[model samples]
Target: MMKIGIVGATGFVGNRATEVFLAQGHEVRPVVRSASSADRLTIKNLDYQIASAFDQSQLADAFKGCDVVIHSILGSPGLIRGSVEPTYKAAQKAGVRRIIYLSSMIVHRSAPAIGTTEASPLVEKQQFPAHPAKIYAERKLLKLREKGSVEVVIFRPGIVFGPRSRWVSDLASQLSQGTAYFINEGQGICNSVYIDNLIHGIQLGISTPSADGEAFFVGDRERVTWFDFYRPFAEAFGVDPAQIPSLPIPEFHHSRKRELISAVTNSQFVQKFLASVPEDFKQNLKNIVPKRNKSSVAVIPQVEEVKQVEHKPTPVVNEMMAELQQSQYKLPFDKAERILGYEPIVSFDEGCRLSIDWLSQLKQFETILKK
Candidate 1:
């Protein structure tokens, strides 16, 4: 069995990678920064290496004699570019044989092409702030492969969803509450991948010789529109999909502007003044001009029952979840399957069920605590 070391194994993606490797009977070492985080992986029987990504001495020691190193580090655009070069240098010096890097689809695709696999020259010219830094990280890994013996594989996954995932949790929370909005009639398409599928891609990256020195996109096979995507979520919540309204872009923008102004002014009187204005002022203004399509009316709450459950959730979390519940996020899985043998183990419906089950359990636990 190969001896593998994982940097950033405490993170969401890294945790899944650890589970995959351990299940495959590989000896795994997880590099972590704290003992508490390392303790959480006890179930995997992984060896622990306490070291920060920037500490080359600690990293070199952690990487020594490992057959493969999975670098799953998360950082801002600047840090991603700056930190990767040194990690590659340390991995080579420590005699690591292979490396797997996780990057986002945004690195290679333009905003408009996000949910589509069809490549456009537009993608090449797009200037997303995060793309250049991701490109730099990929280049550093490739440079090492060319100059040194270590093989490198890069996997770029679309927006990730599954149990305990940011997207899934966000959607669940939104459906439970009632305050999610869609952008521009919610027409924007999105590509998403389940965490299990992403882990499958990573497993192939480590085991497949064809994956060496290459970059691949990982996502679901089916493409979905926003309305269709959220229909199931609303059904799962036992609510009518038609009850969810699409907010006009102008009104949404105006609401956000008022919130920003309130924060900046820091005067309770100013905040109250903003709040007292009709919540639909922007919508009313758009109606007077009659430009573009008549914006859909905001779905008023029909029953007091749903409102109570919605109000119980934290507002920020509820809003994010609502947006996810009403948004379309899917991915192109065919290429990942053909090249990396990747397949999503969890379907979108299955993900929703899992989230609902967790919410049920959480409620039960709360009820027990009150006694």
Candidate 2:
């Protein structure tokens, strides 16, 4: 059994990876930011290290005895270089053989052309916010791969949904609140990869020689639609998809005036100034607006003019979401299939069955419902 060092071991993906590897009899060294976080793991007699991905010293310490290391830290674009670069340098120092970096299908646009592969260009200018960071990390690590010190394998998965995912938990909240709805009647296909299926892909990456220096895209074999995906969850939650209102496909509008004002107001220079404003003073401005009727208050002329131009929709999507919902992005994993011989063992249906079982027992559902 190989000795594995898992960075970000307590996270949704990292914890699951830890469980699967440990169950297979591999020696798992769970690297976390604190000792208490390691308590999340059930297996005893395993090594644990208190280390942050941001700290090179701690990372080197944790990675010293590992044969392989998985970089699964989730963070913003700015945080990617700081975390991933140090891990690479440390792994080199520690004599680690291979490193697995978790990326996502989101590196591409929502509606990529059919048969898109790992070599496809990233959504370089896309405003998804996280895309740039993921792409940046992949490039940085692949550069390290060229150095020949450590073999790097990049695995990208799509719409990862299961328990502990925002997709499930947030949808649960929306269902309970009667606010769950689809953009464009939910006709688009969801390129969903179950959590277990992703773990299966990770397993293949660990042993498959062909996977090194190559990227793989993984997904469920089943062709499930957005409607099909949500319907089951809605029914399990005792909610009806038909009964939930659908919002119109929103037009893309990023108001420069509003953005500028928001940026200025939220800036450090203005934070204290805004906080110092009297609550009574703010209330009096609203109260001072002439009450034309019980339900009607006079809007300032400038405000009324601005509102006419704002054109905000009931909100199914911003431009980005609309772009996604309008088309199908079926990510073909033929390359992963051919090279690594990775096939999704847990079919999407069976995977969902397991997920529903977990959802029933998750404290996340309880906490969300309480909220």
Q: Number of the top candidate by TM-score?
A: 2
TM-score of 2: 0.79
What are the C-alpha RMSDs, in order, of all predicted structures? 13.0, 9.2
Which stretch of 10 consecutive residues in model 2 shows the poorest summed lDDT?
A: 306-315
Please provide, for model 1 over 50-132, each residue's C-alpha lDDT reduced to its tens digit, 9 standing for 90 to 100.
76565677788989878899988775554566556657777888998788888776564534333555232223343334566
- lDDT for model 1, on a 0 to 1 scale? 0.66
- Tell me the whole-model lDDT of each prediction, alpha carbons only: 0.66, 0.76
Q: Which stretches of candidate 2 lie over 4 Å from their true place?
A: 39-46, 252-323, 363-371
Displacement of the residue 175 alpha carbon in candidate 1, Å? 2.8
